[model samples]
Target: MADDRRKNRIFRGSLGLLLLSLVLSGGCWDRRELETLAVVTGMGLNYAAQGDGYEVAFQIVRAAQLQSASGGAGGGGELKPVWILRSTGPTVFEAVRNATFQSSRRLFLSHNQVLIISEAVAKGGLLPALEFFVRDHEPRNTQWLLLTPDEPVEILDAAAGLERVSALAIVDLMKQYQLTSKIKPVYLADYIKTRIEKTTANTLPIIRIYETAGKKELLLDGTAILKEDRLVGFLDHKETRGLLWVLGEVRGGVITVDLPGGGKATFEIFDAIPKVKVEFKEGRVQVKIEIKERAGLGAQTTYADLSTPEQFKKLENLQTKAIEDEIRAALAKAKAYKADIFGFGEYLYKHDHRTWQRLQKEWERYFVDAQVEIKIEAMVEELGLVTRPATYRELRK
Candidate 1:
């Protein structure tokens, strides 16, 4: 009987301990409730009006409103699915912490998708304003980075349209670069890596606010050129495409060329391959770029039929000249700014470190005067559905 009672007591104590361990293990130690978080989806940075500090905008997602929108109620009564909070301080970190004074929930930034910097901030020097995002563990390196000539806050306020959150819409807009290949999307990691390099410059796409029927929308305006960390200049849409072509980032776009007779012909680029060769002659750096593209006939505004081999070769020549002109335009803009957005300096460092070392101190001067040759070979493989114009007399007959 004594042995039986002792065994029962031991079993009871073991059972209790096991149950307690399970309960403790099941509870989350670092859990934060969803209601206590103001999740930041996008951030905008600008120089403060006083010109002594920073103005920051945080686009926070409203969980309740998001849920309501997805349920087909359109946010359950007039409250948008996002909340914009603006704050100012001497530094970005302080500005972020200051947001808690007006916000009910703690700010959470791990979900951030994009960062927009104003021209003032970028021109003044981006490194000072960008330190926080780089050091903070909350923001990811994959976040899309953009520049705006107007107020950065305006970009965050644009309508989402297809997306429930405006920030997500901005992300989707960056993804569309593959469609037109007119602008290259610079992510946070790409900028950081380029900025930290010894001789490489960086570039960011420009975002502008467009108003249609009183509704403001986001539009990609041009390319922002950054020599080191400061904004030096900008490239227009045509120039941006030229830069993209050299970077091998052009996926698809229409290249229009003037026809021999009259009017214009547009070629839909199906494939583009860019090759760059750097050579040194008598200590002079020379960059030779060859761009080969395959395109299909998109449209011919001219009445002349271009189905014959002779006519096709003429059309190809025109397209080649047009491509070379775009490349030259980009090169001229970069030279005017004295910015090596083409990574020529980095190329030299990798291929010939000794030469790069000699020119590293005055790379801008060399880059401005660097000898560049652009060669283009555009082949129109397919002529679309019909070889002749739809309005041609033979087709009509």
Candidate 2:
């Protein structure tokens, strides 16, 4: 009887200990509540005029305001779905922490979608301004990075028609790069990786504020070419497309060319592929780039029937010329700026490392003088609804 009672007591004690362990593990002690966090959607960096420091802007989403806006109440009149918090400090990390002083909740950066840097800050060197983001565990490396000539903070405040949060609206705009393939949509990871390369340079899309009908709007314009971490120059939309072709990043876009006689014709690009070859001969480097593109007829202002073999051939030739022109224009602009936005040097470094070492120091000099051969082959596969322009039958003589 005594042995039986001792065994039963031991089993009960073990059961009680197990129950206490389960109770203790029920809740997460380190978990943070959502209400205590001010979720940041975008960030902007600018050179502060007050002192030698950075002025940081945090675009924090207002959940209550966003909910109200989604419900069609317009945030009960005058309330914005996002709050822009500003702070300044000697370093980017300090500036980020300083944002807490203006808000009751802690600023959480895990959901940040965009980082806009002012031209002034970019010209100096972006690595310093971006160091904190890379070192911290919060901000994601995949967020879109933009360079703005206007105040960086202005990009966060720009009015968006569809998206209640301007930061998200900007992200949507960047994603449209696939539709046009003109603006280069560079993420933080891509930008930093290229910037760190020995010869590869960095290029970021430019954002500016446009005032239309007394309301400010965000406009994505041009490309900011960076030599290492400093802003060297910019490439317009056309030149930017040319760079895209060289980089083989062109996905889809429309190319317009002059008709045989008059008017214009637009071709919708379906596929664009570029092949590059680098050759080192007699102490000089030469690059050959060939682009093969397939497009369909999208629109034409001319009544010329492109259904005929001769007319279609002419159309294909015109498209080829136009593609070549775009590539040439980008090359000319890059040479003028002394910027290797094409990464020809990077190619050589990857394939022919020994040769790259000899020219790495003076790569920019050799790049401007490097011989480039461009060849384009464009094919128009599908015509639009009709064999020619929409009004071809009505306007036929």
Candidate 3:
């Protein structure tokens, strides 16, 4: 009876220990509650005016204000949906951690949508200021990367027309880039890939503030060209689209051309495909860019019936010339900068490794003097509901 009693006591002790272990390991030890985190929607990087350190800006969405804006229980006027928190340090990692001094909750960056880099920082070098975002676990790699001549913090603080958060609004702008095909959207991962490439250069969309009639707004204006991780020059909207054309990223946009007789015709670009061939002849590098494009007659002020074969053929020719002109303009600017934003060097590396190996050392010099030929085949596939200009038809009647 005494031995049985001792066995029962040992079994009971083992059961108690097992229950305790289960209770201790049931939940995550490092789990944080939602209310303890400050959700960051946007981040901006700029140079600190006082020292050689960096300034980081975090746009934190105010949850209560956002709820109120969405018809939650709020009696008074709407409050600003985001709080712009700024901090500075000698390094980006330190700068990010310093934000905790001003913020009550831990800053969470998983939801960050956009990263704005100042012109000053971009001109100096992007890698130094961008190392933290690239290496950090919290910040996502898919966030849109933008460059701004204006203050990045100010850009984040600017008003968002539809979205309560300016970062998300900027995301929307990037999504609609296909509609215009004039802006190039670069993600953090994409930027990193370009930065690591030996022959290829990088470009980021330029965002700035526009004010009129006592109201301020954000607009994507142009493209910032980066060579060797430093800003070399910029491409205006027209030239930007030209770059997009060579990259075959043009989805939908309008092309307006003047007619030989009078007025102008607008063609809505339905699709565009580009074929680039890099040839090495007699130790000389040449690039041939051929573009195949399909468009429709969106609007015309000319009296000619563009639906007919003769008139349509002329229209096609004009469209082709216009596209070629854009491509040439972009090529001229890129060569002037001696920046290979077209990935010609990358193409050589992939297709002709031996040639790339020979020219890899002085690729920039070769690129500056390289011969580029452009050919465009544009077809106007649709003429819309009417054959000719409505006004012209009425006048004929």
| Best prediction by lDDT | 3
Query: In candidate 2, what are the lDDT values of residues 244-361, reduced to their tens digit?
Result: 9989998998999988678999889998999998777776779999999999989888676777877778889999999989999999989888888888988898898988889999
Q: In candidate 2, which residue pairs get closer than 3 Å at backbone N, Cα or C atoms, i.e. clash? A: none
Q: On residues 213-262, what C-alpha lDDT tens digit does candidate 1 reach at each position?
A: 88888888889999879998999988998898898989998989998767
Q: What does the lDDT read for residue 322 in candidate 2?
A: 92
lDDT of 3 at 109: 88
TM-score quality measure for candidate 2? 0.93
TM-score of each: 0.91, 0.93, 0.94
Total clashing pairs in model 3: 0
Best by TM-score: 3
Model 1 CA RMSD to the hidden true structure, in angstroms: 3.1
Each prediction's RMSD to truth: 3.1, 2.8, 2.4
How many clashes (backbone N, Cα, C below 3 Å) per candidate? 0, 0, 0
- lDDT by residue for model 3 over 162-238, one digit each (tens)? 78889999999999998889999999999999888898999999999999667678999999999999999999999
Ranking by lDDT: 3, 2, 1
Estimate the lDDT of model 3: 0.92
**In terms of TM-score, which candidate is stronger, 2 or 3?**
3
